[model samples]
Target: MWKFTLRRILIMIPQIILLSILIFILAKMMPGDALTGMIDPNVSPERLEELREKLGWNDPWHIQYADWVGGLVQGDFGQSFRFKMPVTELIGERIVNSFWLSVATLIFTYLIAIPLGILSGRYNDSLLDQTITGYTYLGFATPLFIFALVMLWVFGFMLGWFPTSGSVSPGSEPGTFAYVMSKINHLILPAIAMALIATVNTVQYLRSEIIDTKQKDFILTARAKGASESRVYNRHILRNSLLPIAAFFGYEITFLIGGTIFVETIYNYPGMGLLFFESITLRDYSVVTAVVLLFGVAAILGALLSDIILSLVDPRIRIK
Candidate 1:
């Protein structure tokens, strides 16, 4: 297990480098310089040139990449051109808020998906299975933003059961029970929105896994041994069936990251998703690069997490 984990960690090094280079190239391809949004519109050409020189914008891309990587190693993510603050400080709190939303979404996703999957898979061809299938199709057809707005409108505008915007309510002192409750209350709607968007594939994956695992020779053998159906499924089938779902979480991570941009924007929630949208609009390249890099790193780590989980569930993975 240690060897496998170490190898995977080692593999990430080159992936990160390549990902960085790709982002840099893409950033370079944008029409204007980062300085475009940093100054007054009427600034003189000479002033813009001077500012460009000061920021080493004229430097070779390789040199700039080196500087950026060096800064990353030293914990300096550069300054936000628009905000004029350290990138880390600008995004630190927002990342936490995003983390809360992402975690909540994933939790709810599994909570809803796993049970439905088990039920539909366990009782295949029944009314419940048909209902779950219909729900998945409906969920797959609805756009995430549409679902979010419906949730916002029905729950936020008409019903008045949940707050539609923001991660916390005003005048709730941080760290208090009221503040915590406010956060959760504000969280429920958006989290559910993203979770429903996230749950579709998980449900399908686990359902298929359960169905396939049920027919495996081992499951048949267990049943042949006169084990009760419950024992056969509980002790053997479920354990083997969940392995694929564990691996599927990698896709979930990327999905949630992408979904958050839409969800956060709709909810007006303060998080990296909204930040990414705002930064792109403002052409705040420093924040953009940071957020994109964070997202890429998340994807890479998510793959690693899947491997780790696979190792945990299937001892053969660790033994090899």
Candidate 2:
């Protein structure tokens, strides 16, 4: 397992470099530079040239890429053109809120999806199963932005049960239980909005996996051995059924992290997603690259974790 993890980490280095190159290309394709808006209409050509030189925009693409990579190796993500701050610092300022929000969404999504999925599978074709299936289908069909807007309107505007925007209320006291609770309160709508589609996908996948597992020869053999229905379900069916779900758990983290863009933007939450939106609008290449790299790393890590978990849960996987 340790060797596998190390190997995966080693593999990630090249993947990230390739992803960085792609991001650099996209950044170069943008119509203008960081100084495009900043330059005065009457500014002398020499002054503009000096500014470009100072910003290293005059460097060859390969040289710029090399410098960027060197800075990345030294733990510097470069400076954001729009924000005028180091990309690392800008991301650091926002990542914690996004991380916590994603965590909360993951917890809520699984807590709701798994048990309902189990019951739906256990009573396949029943009214309960049909109802859950319909609900999940609705979730899948709904657009995330539309759902976010509706949730904000219904819960925030109409009922006023939750705050409409931001990670927490202004002037929230730090290091207090009240502050924590306030943050959670502000998180409810966006988290739910983000998790809605994910929950449906999880439920649908688990239900399908469980149904197939219960029909397998192993399950039939367990039943023929005079195992009680509950025992067979708990000891055999459920355990086997969860292996795929467990593997998917890691990918779900990646999904939720990416999905946070809509939720955080709609809610005006101060997180990576919101920052991503703002950075893109302002053409902040450094920050945009940093954000993309962060998401890419997360996805690679998630996939690696999923493989490791699958191997652990099913010995056949490890042996193979």
Candidate 3:
């Protein structure tokens, strides 16, 4: 396991480097630039040239990339022109909010998906299975923004059951119960919006897995040995059936980040997703590069973690 892990890490080094290079190139190739923010209609050409030179925008792409990589190695992701702060500091604050949103969405997704999927799979061809299938189809078909809007209109505007936007109510004191409650209330709509999409995916995967696993020779053997159906399922089939779902768990981490952007934007929650959107609009290259690189790294890490979990769940993976 250790050898496999080490090898995976080694393999990721080149991949990460190539990904970073691509991110940098894309950022540079964008039509506008952060220097636009420094320009005024009255600003002279010479002043713009000076600003460009100061930012090393005058340098070749390779030189700029080398400098960027050097700073990245030293834990400096560069300064964000959009916020006039260090990119790391900006990311730090937003990533935490995004992480919590993702966590809540993940918990909600599994909590709803797994048991429902199990029921649907166990009672296949029954009313419960048909109902679950219909629900999953609806969930899959619903556009995230439309769902978010409906959530906002019903819960936020009409019923007033939940706050529509932001992580907390204004003037709510931090570290207090009211603040925490405010955060959760504000979180519900967006998290649900993100979770709904993922729930469909998990339910479909688990339902299929359960159906396939239950038909295996081993499951039949256990049944023939007089093991109760539930016992056979819980003790034998469940774990084996979960291997693919475990792999999806890793991909879901990155999926949540991408989803968070849309969800957070709709809810006006301050997180990395909203930040990415704002940075792109402002042509904040530093923030854009940093966010893209972070996303790339996250995706790679999630895949690697999934492989490790797959190995643990199925020892055959370790052999391969």
Q: Which ten residues in a row have the lowest lDDT in candidate 2?
A: 311-320
Q: Per-residue lDDT of 227-300 in model 1, one digit per residue for the tens? A: 99999888888887876788778768888888999999999999999999998988888788889999999989
Tell me the deviation in Å of residue 160 in model 1.
Answer: 1.8
Alpha-carbon TM-score of each model against the true structure? 0.93, 0.93, 0.95
The top-ranked prediction according to lDDT is: 1
**Candidate 2 structure quality by residue, lDDT tens digits, 1-320:** 66766776788789878988988878878887766766568887788789889888889988988888899889999888778788898999899999899988888888889998999999999999999999998998888889999999999999999998888888989999989999999887888888777889889888998899999999999999999999999998888887778888889878776688888999999999999899888878788878987888888888888888887776566532
Write down the lDDT of every candidate, Cα atoms only: 0.88, 0.86, 0.87
Backbone clash pairs for candidate 3 read none
Which lDDT tens digits does candidate 3 get at residues 183-297? 8888888887788788888888889998998999999999999999789988987877776787788989877867887888888899988999999999888998999899889
How much is 317 displaced in model 3, in angstroms? 2.8
Models ranked on TM-score: 3, 2, 1
**lDDT value, residue 59 of candidate 3:** 99
